[model samples]
Target: MKTNFDFLMPSVNFFGPGVIEKIGDRAKMLNMKKPLIVTDAFLEKVENGPVAQTLTSLEAAGVDYVVFNGVEPNPKVRNIQAAKKLYLESGCDSIITVGGGSAHDTGKGTGIILTNGDDITTLAGIETLENPLPPLMAVNTTAGTGSELTRHCVITNEETHLKFVVVSWRNIPLVSFNDPLLMLDVPAKLTAATGMDAFVQAIEPYVSTNRNPITDGQCLQAIKLIEGSLREAVANGHNVEARTAMVEAEMLAGMAFNNADLGYVHAMAHQLGGQYDAPHGVCCALLLPVVEEFNIISDPERFKELAVAMGENVDGLSTRDAAELAIKAMRQMADDVGIPRSIKAIGAKPEDFELMAENALKDGNAFSNPRKATKAQIVELFQKAYDAE
Candidate 1:
């Protein structure tokens, strides 16, 4: 942690039901003549999905775009290469990403490769990019991951079977949109996973070693909002109030972690995502409780605060007891939202735990964990998460 720190976010952000409607005008304001639209195949195929809506907005604003919808659930290095190729060949001057983390990260990685170098692997660490990215706008469809407004991008290497994070202030999108209306049709399981991802994002930052007062307030408020609305949003995706609340919560959590950094949950989850090709949010949900349990002794008072933020009734309890309630609350909330309890459910094997643990310790997010974990302890956490029930 530094005595002096900088707070960062996109210069322009719009949040509301129909805020996506301004994508075209926003792009024009940024002077985007022809932008490459990066997204996943599912969104491209949906008749009225996020990509289609973005296209409608762009066309209405007379902005031309070429679409690359090959992004995977966990975007690979090749995905960035492909997107960058498309951007150059199509004569695009800007980039617009639709959907969540995968799409947004693909766009960010492409931007980095375009200006800094042709290879993205060399730019994996913090503050490695020497050049500013081309104009980029992230129109977020999901309320999870917060890639839309963050300075982080995660890309998987196919050959090594590992995920690497790219952290740079330059990776922040020039504009961001969080429209709850766009999230109304998300599948129940996905909604649950994403909402829990947001929860972990909040909890991890609040307890992070690098946390400052601004991020602490953001994380706690996000925790409270998620506790109040995530369940309803998962149970009934059409619930506008719940959906809107989740959008706010996810954005706040994103902003919090963007500044405060994250912890072991993200570090370990990245390994699982790269190893098994599991859903990122599901990996986070399964690992969060186990890692936080290990982290409780680092800051029991903070855990007690988290308990209250999660709506746990910890009145008159000892700090340690209240902190234990926080863990229980996490378990119950995950259960209520249909998150699986074990990494075993996602195909993570014991034989792979040692390597995953080693890789996790090297992850950028691991440095800020409230507890400095040894490789042995990380492996133990993986085993505990795998055997959880």
Candidate 2:
């Protein structure tokens, strides 16, 4: 309920089919003549990736550019350094990221180092980036990550397994593309995982310390869109309307979490991603219900909204009972989506729990959790996550 607040997003956004055509025009407006298109090698070969379209548009606009498609999922620090080297060598003045969060983050991490000299490690934490990163545009392929609009990038340190969140106002893309058509060829498993990622964003922000009226509206609406459409998108991948709803859900969730921040699910999931190389959304799906159940004791009332947004009917249950019901609903959703219930099932070792918990407690997102946790408590949460449910 703070009277003063702040919001972050792309200065311009394009939603719906065929909006990718304006990508070159947007780059021209940014005074970007030579743009570097960042993406992964796999996506570069895929039918739906924006590499071809982006190249076509940039060429038509008479913009000079180079393609650097060596990025990988759970992208690493070296990826940024390599892209930065290419950007410098090719004389690219701007960047266009044309895949998922990995591509978007690679562009951002590279752009930061490109303008600010080198030693990419200097831009590690929040606002450590003092120099303005080159103008960047994010043309997102996946509906999740919301990286297209958010000013946060999770770049892993290859040697340390540390997931550094580079949060700066400068990281927000100049414009974002959410054309559902780009998402048409996404496989069902990934569709489910990223969709749940959006769901967690909305749910976590509802109870974050920084929650405000504006973010509240966005989070709840995003949650509803996800609960309604994520399954449809997963079951019938070609359902354009469902895909459209899912894209909206991801977009709204980005708007919500970008400003309000997130909760323990993301904090713990970050550790899993940095440590075990787990899919970000799969780790979130495993941790979401566990964290919710652990957190409900602190704010049972909040789960009322959580339950409703997750599509649970709270007819006559007590707040505590309804909270448990919400947890059940989330667990069911995870099961339905084929997400494994435990870290052990997903190849995580029980011995790793203590260190993972240790790292999880220190994640900045944990600072905003409604139920503040100690290291020992996080260890307990990890133990629960270790045993396959």
Candidate 3:
């Protein structure tokens, strides 16, 4: 363990039902008279959706705002530029993002460009942002991704078909909302994918080389929460208890990974997202077990712990055997949630594995992986995931 580490999160967080109704008051408290609302077309268009709820609150509080509903899946650089242009043109003084990772990331990237005065791609590395962002509030619409509470902004380069992450304390939102009510409308498939995303986030951090005591507690609890609620949440999105557990789980996973960092699952999954335009959560679900199979030898003891958190019966099993059970649990959870078993099912081509592996090795998250993998090994991992049953 390191001698010291920092725990980071938004200054203010709201959880549970009816918390979203407080957005207007929170925005007013922040002196946000005029703000830019960043979101996707779906959120903006849906009646009585999170965006509509936010607007209602803002209107009641006498706050004026302009909406930018151009965020696409795997938010691209141009989305940031466009949102920035709107923020400038409308004289908006703050930002409120509504939706999952894509919308939140678009808002974060816009904040970066507004203050830093450059393309988002130029600020892709860790702590590269210099200026403090304008007042920002994240009104989360999904219980997945946990973008509402993270300092990481992942934006895709449309030209190169690569997703790049910008990590900075300044990127963290000033406020966050996690009302499970917002997630009640999500489809089962998406619920499964995002839940698995949270599962991967928790597991990756638990075994990270940078793991610490604080993050360890958060990761294990998050794992337990995900294991207990993900299936029920996916099976019945309207179940308030399950939805609440999942949102809390995702937030905890976000907090842990934000501090402890992640490993190969995210590094490789990001490549799949950029390469095939695949859903980030599904990509993560597909790669989680495959990557960990290569990494378990580095710390079978940790894997055994993970198996327990995942509710596996490791009684009387050796460390290595229990570690293998963790992988089995991961696969079972994903399969139960309807996630495909192989990357090839999502249109991944074996021919592209080499290039994707090279890019995966260069991803920032790769640095904290428990096992150091060469490019050839990463390629083999890709091939294995593709060929997995």
Highest lDDT: give the candidate number: 1
- Which has the higher lDDT value, candidate number 1 or candidate number 3? 1
Candidate 1 displacement at residue 141 in angstroms: 0.6
TM-score of 2: 0.97
lDDT (Cα, 0-100) at 37 in candidate 2: 90
Each model's TM-score? Answer: 0.98, 0.97, 0.99
Q: Which lDDT tens digits does candidate 3 get at residues 1-389?
A: 55488899988999999899999999999999899999998889899999999999999999999999999999988899999988999999999999998999999999999999767888888999889999899999777798899989999999999998999999999999999999999999889988999999999999998889998999999999999999999998999999999999999999988888998999999999998999999999999999999999999999999999989999999999999999999999999999999998889999999999998988989999999999999999999999999
Model with the higher lDDT, candidate 1 or 2: 1
Write model 2 residue lDDT over 213-309, tens digit each, in one string. Answer: 9999998898888878888899988999999998998999999888998888998898888887778888899999899888888778888778887
Please give the lDDT score at residue 44 for candidate 3: 90
Model 2 ranges off by over 4 Å: none
Cα deviation in Å at residue 214, candidate 3? 1.0
Error of 3 at 286 (Å): 0.3
Candidate 3 accuracy as TM-score: 0.99
- Per-model C-alpha lDDT, please? 0.93, 0.85, 0.93
User: What is residue 351's positional error in candidate 2, in angstroms?
Assistant: 1.7
